[model samples]
Target: MIWTEINGKRGSIEIVSAIYIWIMKLPEAITHVTIYSDTCSGQNRNQYIAAFLLHLVHTHKTIKVIEQKYLESGNSFMEVDSMHSAIEKEKRFTEAYSIIDWKRIMQRARSNRHNKNVTPYNVTEFLYQDMIDVKALALMIIKNKTIAEDGETVHWFENKMSMI
Candidate 1:
C-alpha cells in the first residue's frame, strides 16, 4: 500500500492492526507471513498481535512462523521514518489547533499537486476493526483446540489483566 499521511492520535495503531487482521484472514494452507513495520510502539503492538496469530497457527499445525522485522532494509527504515515524521507533523498541528481546520488544510494540500488521492482519515480505526476480527478468529481456533484435546468446555475468565 502506498504511504499516506495520518493525522489522528492512534493512526499508527490502526494501520498495524489492519495489516495484522488482513494477514490472519488468509487460508490455512498459507504457511508463512512477513510484516514490515516502523520502530514505534504501534508497530510493537502489531508484532505482538502477529505473534499471537502465529502461535495459533502453530498450535493447529497449520503453519510455521518465519522471520519478522520492523526494518527490512536501510532504505525501508528511512522511508518508514520519513512517512512517520510527516504524519507526526500533521498530528501536532491538529492537536495544537483545530482538527476541522487541519483537516481542511490537509484536504486542500492533498488536492493541490503531489498527491490527490490521499486524505487523512481514521485508517487506524479500520485496522483496529481488522485486528478485532483476527482476535476473535484466533480465540475460536483456541477454543476448538481446547475442546478437541480435553473434551470439555473451557472458558477464559479474567481476574486481572495488565499491559505491564
Candidate 2:
C-alpha cells in the first residue's frame, strides 16, 4: 500500500497515529513491511513516536517492522511535491505568506470527506464496461467464445474486463 502526504507540516501526529494503529491491527503473519514517508523535518518526531509504538508492539512477538524510510524519487512522491509547490505558489497570491498556508490547505483537503457532487459515477464510466464474471477470471486460462486464440492464458485483463 502507498500513502502520500503533501501537507507534511500539519497533522503529523494524527497521520502517524492512524498508520500505527493500522499496522498494529494487521495479522501476525505479516512479519516484514516497508513504510515510506516524505523527508519533512517536522514529521521526524512523529515518525519516531510511531516507530517507538511499533517497537512496543513487536516486543509482544507479533509482526516485525522491517524498513521505514523517506520516499525520495518515487512517482507518487514527485507528483505530490509538485502539487504541493503549486499550491504554495497559489497561496502566495492570497498573501505574501510562507508555505505554511499551502500546507494547511492540503491537510484540510486530505482530512475532509468528499462532496456529493464528486460522485464516482460523475468521474468514471467503469460501470458500463462488459467484463468477465468472477468464475471466468478465476480460471487459470479463459475460454471465452469471443476470444479466438487457442488455449491462451489470461495474464492481463483489458480495460473492458474487470480482474477477479
Candidate 3:
C-alpha cells in the first residue's frame, strides 16, 4: 500500500487497520483467521492490533476466532519473500522513478526465473486516510475493555499467549 509521508508511518494503527480491513474482505464462510505475523512489536504484536483483533472476533458475526501466530526468525521462507528478494536484488543496482515503476518492478520480479513458485502479487492498496476511523476504533477498544476487580485495572487484548 502506497501512501504519502503525511498520512502516517508503518505503525500499530496502520498495521492493525490494514489487517482489520483484510479480515473484512474474507469470504463469509471463513469464520476463523490465523494470522502468521513477523515479530515486529510496533507493526504486528502490539496492543493496538491485539485489541482490534479481539474486537473483530467478538463483534463480527461471520468471524468467530483469530489466532495470531509468530514465525521464528529466518525460518518461514515465504514465496512473497522470495519475490521481494528478487525486487531488492534488482533494485539494489537499479532505480525506480516512481510508484508505478516500482509496481512494474515487482511484477517483473514475480516473473523472474530465479524466483520460483512466485505468483503474481497485485498491489492492492487500502487508502488509510479514508479507511481508518480512529473514533470508531478507539470506541471498540474501550467497549471491549475487561475491568478487573480493583476497578483501576482495565485489560484489553491478550491475557494469554499461545504458539498455535
lDDT of 3 by residue, 71-141 (tens): 66677765657667877876765588866677767666656364577675565554546445544665767
State the lDDT of candidate 2 residue by residue for 14-104, as single tens digits.
3454455567677878876665556554443232334344444446466544555555434445454665574455455455244454445
| TM-score of each model, in listed order | 0.37, 0.35, 0.70
Against the reference, the lDDT scores of all candidates come to 0.45, 0.41, 0.64
Quality of model 2 by C-alpha lDDT? 0.41
Candidate 1: pairs in clash: 14-124, 18-127
Please give the lDDT score at residue 149 for candidate 2.
52
* TM-score for candidate 1, residues paired by index: 0.37
Rank ordering of all candidates by lDDT, starting from the highest = 3, 1, 2
User: For model 3, what is the alpha-carbon lDDT of residue 138?
Assistant: 53
Candidate 1, residue 129: the lDDT equals: 26
The per-prediction tally of clashing pairs is 2, 0, 0
- Pairs of residues at least 3 apart in sequence or in different chains that clash in candidate 2: none
lDDT tens digits by residue: candidate 1, 51-118:
35555446644556544455433445554455556655556645435445554544433343546566
Model 3 bad stretches (over 4 Å): 74-80, 92-94, 112-119, 131-164
Winner on TM-score (1 vs 2): 1
